[model samples]
Target: MSHRPKVIAGVALAALLAGCGEQAATAPSPAASAAAPTSSAAPSAPATPVAAPDLEADPETVATGLDVPWGLAFLPDGTALLAERDTARVLRVRPGARPEQVLTVPGVEARGEGGLLGLAVSPGYEQDRWVYAYYTAAQDNRIVRFRLDGGGAPEVIFDGIAKAGNHNGGRIAFGPDGMLYAGTGDAARTATSQDRDSPNGKILRLTPDGDPAPGNPVAGSPVYSLGHRNVQGLAWDARGRLFATEFGQNRLDEVNQIDPGANYGWPEVEGTGGGSDYKDPLVTWPTDQASPSGAAIVGDTMYVAGLRGERLWAVPLGGGAPRAHFTGEYGRLRTVEVAPDGALWLTTSNTDGRGDLREGDDRVLRFPAG
Candidate 1:
């Protein structure tokens, strides 16, 4: 069947989807999503996956008057934490409510494209209550975990990734296997992407307690995949396939299917056709239409937030060209995520010093993806 943007997942499923990153107020929590997958390496969803939600053309404004908001992870209560890219502040956000500053992360050095970036709630949050963040520190990019009420310094889980005025890849998420995954930039140093020993320009996988994941392709190292320019988005399909959105050179932007130890040809290639040594991107967009950042997969379709393109692209996993939605409506889209209630939460990045700023330059929007 051809892909359509609209499909009903029912009201009950809608409520369930609205809490993708947050805890459910009534019953099980998002941490349940982190429960050890049956397969320590790969966990594919059942054959009969539920129908994916549709993406509504119009959207609802959730919150306003914010700086450049980047990382977004929801709480168990269906609320979310918003990371301000420049201010290094974390805020609690929900619809129809004013966003309140929750904490100011220290050691966040907001350079050109750095500062506080991605956020992820612990899948085992009920017991651990840990929140993870990726940000630019004084000397390098780092990943840290902390608790809202723990009243202590954040624990640096992973550090020593390169930092730069730009290309400090800072998107992170937990996979179905319950391991933490991070995308790092080459920090403008093209060689780092091809060097297996370098942490930059690669996707790193780690255990929840700051150790390298046991099943990583490289033993004793967090490097899961290598040879990426700058990966800003990571998501999994219903069948446990991992996809990542990347920022390329002026020539092309790409979305690649991530494989353990796979090489995506950065300094060697841009879009595709890198002989047999590198994996080609599943989808490629012009730099103007993509500069893709955060993405959220609902069923078979992946919705990605575009930065320079100023639009949202809905891609079909079964195979097809991506369709753009809300193009130019929300300036400089930063992040897009699926909510437990089956809606899509998108953040605008016009205030991030690169786009045209409007009344509410940087804001959060809710799309009816139910």
Candidate 2:
């Protein structure tokens, strides 16, 4: 686990999960409340109709001994890359090999819910060889990209989003449109979620070079949508509909249908205000049972990772209610990605100074789509 050097030495396990390596809630959204809750609500039912997904499978252990793995990305050749939150190291796992350290990111302040957070392999990886990441430093949170070959230093592409010990939103991915999208938190500032001018508490769209993506809701601005508090997951469906999950404050957690220029009620409303001025969540859960983290969409179902709920949730598309999978079986599911081979790749966060870490506490798991 020593990170004294830069290069990761080896590679480990590999399997093509059909479309893997791809890629909320709501309460007052942590924007209305400045204090973090000591405990979440008890597991409860989804607010809408609930039904099972078309596919479900038991998970198989893929890799172990990973300390606080947060982000996962897949290479063109099927190698999976993961990031450790506290260590700031990127590790690679190929097929049937031991997980080896790839490179240690420099200047990551591994404090609270920060450190090395999210990772995204370039869609043009075969040509560009760039890997993007979002992490926290002493002063703020930022996004940077580096060559996958480890030939150059990490270049800062975006910065200035506020950071806090807890609600530092850190999920980043490339949309089907090939634009880079990032989810951010309000940094305990309620006003930021309502501030269209600030990047904090918003879903941002940017070109590959970190400039605001063209056709944004506002001219010359990166903000795609505002009024979000601690969004950790972003995924797109077959129709290119963007979905995001947000951590709620105290009452309701939510899954929202993201639209450009749409204002998702944060400080103004928690779940559904039924007002035309704000977009409402497609699905809502008690903050306890669905502290949603990372997410992936396969077919008509969207798979969401639950942190406080300790379960994987499957939401049927077209506004059906969501159902929980693997309830309480895995401790603190942090991230879920669909593999290229049609399986789901999941990670655990029990060792992130929170949940009880059992044997093989922090590990990577694979669940083939049934």
Candidate 3:
């Protein structure tokens, strides 16, 4: 199957915005999608997985006037640090205030889905005041850290990953275990994804200092897993199990339980190959409906931000049938984060050159999360 651009999602919703240009009404329930998988495909049956929480309340617009916001991370003080992909600017937003530009990164390439992407506050942020970012540079994709005060230059902690016009993974987060985890795309090079020596197309585990984490899948190698086309989201459940959302080539999109040293077939097989060596996705969706981006886990449920699909997905931690919400209601969902106040914060990506732009082309929305 060829990769067709599913442009209907974001464009259709632009005409439905309120007078203030916000999505004020509750979205209709999603139609049953055949792409959703059942529990039988999961790694294991979860023991008493938590039920889905309520998000029935109308989502509130938290911030507006964003230019293709791509990443969201909250501070201890409840301020949101947002990243704009093409702008290479990080904005700090309060719950009821406009977003303020806090930091601007230098040397960003910002071309074709590659730019200043994922942002993560250091685990010891209160003391260290460090905020990490994954972005595309002129030569390769890299990760850098900067202080919150904006006084000093960005410290390049990691670099030399391959770069291209597309498929630059660019999602970074500090794991529960205190290691920095990064998801990288294949740079449109299929061979690089399968190459252990190449950093592209792999989930990387690193120390705060950018060295490979101890006890990694391979000695002295930063790669924690291999064989990915474009892994844009990474989250951890209460049990510290890692989950990731992947963009497939043409046929499928995936949510996989990531394991150390595991190989998820890319350029070889997709969806389910029934191979023991390659791990299968816990859930697979049609490529048109689920170009999943960012993910967050709250309690025993995981929420994925769907881009092409234009929806939010709730999946059980123990692996089961997934549910969809706000389908086509908020066009081109970019990032979904569990906010400090226990709300689900999401950003729209209609302004990212792929969707129809409205009066408020991109905005931050808050949904009640139990």
Q: Which candidate achieves the best TM-score against the true structure? A: 1
lDDT of 2 by residue, 1-370 (tens): 1111111111110110011010023222222122221112111221211232333555677888888999998887777999999999999975467788889999899888989999998889989989999999887888989986778789888888788888888999988777889999998898888776677888888877787777665546777777788899998766566789999999888887676666776888777763656777767898889899999888757889999999988887644457788788778999998766666788999999889887897989886655
The reply for model 1, stretches above 4 Å from the true place, is 1-40, 44-54
The alpha-carbon lDDT assigned to residue 272 of candidate 2 equals 74
Name model 3 segments beyond 4 Å from true.
1-53
Q: How should the candidates be ordered by TM-score, best one leading?
A: 1, 3, 2
The prediction achieving the highest lDDT against the true structure is 1
Tens digits of per-residue lDDT for model 3, 29-142? 122111222212112222222334467988788898889999899898888899999999999987777888988899888999999999999979999998989999998999
Error of 1 at 296 (Å): 0.5
TM-score of predicted model 2? 0.84
lDDT of 1 by residue, 1-43 (tens): 1111111123322222111122221122223333332324654
What lDDT does candidate 3 reach at residue 145?
91
Per-model tally of clashing residue pairs: 18, 31, 1
| Span of ten consecutive residues with least summed lDDT in model 1 | 1-10
Order of models, best lDDT first: 1, 3, 2
- TM values, all candidates: 0.87, 0.84, 0.85
